[model samples]
Target: MTNRLEQTKALAGEARLAVLTWLAEPDRHFAHQETGKPSEIGVCVTLLTEKLSMAQPTVSRHLELLRRAGFVSVRKIGRWSFFRRNEDAIKDYKEWMNEHL
Candidate 1:
């Protein structure tokens, strides 16, 4: 149990935490561009990279971590990938933290 808790904490590192925060309010954090539309599915990776002020690859790595942690969901469109918050998973995580931490 302790190991699992520590692992979970480690997974939500600073960058991933920031990603989750921004993803919570996609409309405010990411802009809708002419090339892509922001919807319930998610915001584009390009917008995320710009908003995060990080390279596309770096942002993608962070997003991948968040996805593995079940904090975000992915939607692949054409050649691009969009991401959005997984509210249910986040809620469960919070509950687990409250109970365990």
Candidate 2:
């Protein structure tokens, strides 16, 4: 399991932070997706890349870190990689902050 410090590092930086914020309300932020419910299946990386205005590799790297940190969850539908925030883990983190920080 990843330590708290590692998860903290994953949440660092502007792009990654924006990613989490967008994922917090995928339906509102990424409402253009016509394939599936973003809240349930997650948003496509292509859409996220466009939203972030960053390279796919960069966004993918940020997502990978978040996935490892348990702040995000991913789903694969054929060739597309969909991503969404892990609300349970986020709530736990918030509660942890309230108690420890």
lDDT of 1 by residue, 4-50 (tens): 45438636577778777887777677656555545566888888788
Q: What's the lDDT of the predicted structure labeled candidate 1?
A: 0.75
Cα-based lDDT at residue 55, candidate 2: 92
Worst 10 residues of 1 by lDDT: 1-10
- In terms of lDDT, model 2 sits at 0.89
Pairs with steric clashes in candidate 2: none
List, residue by residue over 41-101, the lDDT tens digit for candidate 2.
9999999999999999998998999998899999999999999888888887778779987
Best by TM-score: 2
Error of 1 at 40 (Å): 2.1
TM-score of 2: 0.93
